[model samples]
Target: MGLEVERVNEIAARVAASSGLEVVEVDMRGSGNKRMLRIFIDKPGGVTHEDCANVSRELGTILDVEDVIPGGSYVLEVSSPGLDRKLSRPADFQRFVGSRVKLTTRNPVNGNRYFEGRLESFQDGRLTLELGAPKKKVKAGDSAPQKVEMDLSNVEKANLVPEI
Candidate 1:
């Protein structure tokens, strides 16, 4: 279950990169008898159904050639990340600037640890976010980034919150 998914993800990544797209995320699940592998991808132009189809065809051939999946019957699903992307990498934070994000910390901060706010910046292992409070502006290269200091280890989970 685990290694097969990783292998599929690796194949999806290679095929996407070769096709000028970015592999977003991959999910592998089972329905008691069948397995489903969902591969998400994105790019500067966003991703279309055609893109997913193309990746599915190509990566499918690659996976079959590699025999990553055994005799277990499975279905392959290729998709896009949509608006709510799981923030896993520092690069994910940078990609989501100017958007609302929900984050939980490893330990509490300011009586409550969970935060949902406007993502400001991510640079040099630092993430600065403006919580939904009184609008206090902070200039570039100032104390604002310091106040929002959160060690990467403190990030338990992060997701782009839908602004609606």
Candidate 2:
């Protein structure tokens, strides 16, 4: 099953690249005939409805030809990752430095699993975040905002917190 998902990711990446886009994520869910394959794509300026339509058509045909999933009908959907896009890769974090983000770690750090802060930097596979709200109150003139440093490997999920 994992291999099938990897194959789908590879196929989606290759197809998206040919179409001048990058595959942000490929998700395969459900089982049997109910399975659905969702592919998220993006580029410098962002993707259009046409981009989604083209990728969907091309990837669907390729998957069908490759016989990747065997005897099952799966719904194929391709689209832009959107404003609150997920940060799945280390480079994603690096690209969005200074943006607000909300992330969850696989294991609790400082007895907490969730964090929302401004991304400060990403270097050597580590991320530094300027925590937006301090866990404890400090006098106005006492201290600067707190910071948290975490390794990429510890991240279970992360998304850009769109600042409106």
Candidate 3:
């Protein structure tokens, strides 16, 4: 993370924590006059519009006063992670154990880089996935394994598979 992003993240975490929220992710995109700062936040039951507005109000002020964002003009958007929230951090994987997830690996695992399955467990910087049945029909003798394990380093991207 860049120094500015780290500083913004620190400020965001502080502001979010004050309102009983967790800062899921802090992203700074674009550049120059079109810079955009997006902060994703969450709580047990999910976040509300008021929660987002309040955090935006406070965090934006702090960022401006602290001059954490460098450029004076930038769009600050605060919102919940939503149902299909990202699973980037180890804590995210640990917290969502038993939930379905779709992930792409940095390299192929079992000749496949993509997987969607139940997160059975996360331990020792690795995760065990209980692979779900394939969407396509299986041949007489060709079938995927019931379980697979991979290190967290291999995961390039991952998101919850919303059951609903």
Q: Which candidate is the best by TM-score?
A: 3
lDDT per residue, candidate 1, 13-116, as tens digits? 89999889988888988864488888989997688899999999998888878788887567888988877778888778888888898888889765457777
What is candidate 2's lDDT per residue for 1-164, written digit by digit as tens? 78998999998999899989999998888998998888999998899999999999988998899899886798988989989999989879998999999999998776667889999999999999988875555678876347888899999999999899
Report the lDDT tens digits of candidate 3 across residue range 1-164. 39888888888999999999999998888988889899999988899999999999999889888788775599999999988999999999999999999999999887788889999999989999999986455669988878989999999999999997
The segments of candidate 3 whose C-alpha lies over 4 angstroms from its true place after superposition are 135-140
Which ranges in model 1 have alpha carbons more than 4 Å from their true place?
133-147
State in Å the error of residue 135, model 1: 16
Query: Against the correct fold, how does model 1 do in TM-score?
Result: 0.83
Q: Which ten residues in a row have the lowest lDDT in candidate 3?
A: 134-143
lDDT over C-alpha atoms for residue 77 of model 3: 98
Give each model's clash number. Answer: 0, 0, 0
Local accuracy by lDDT, each model: 0.80, 0.89, 0.91
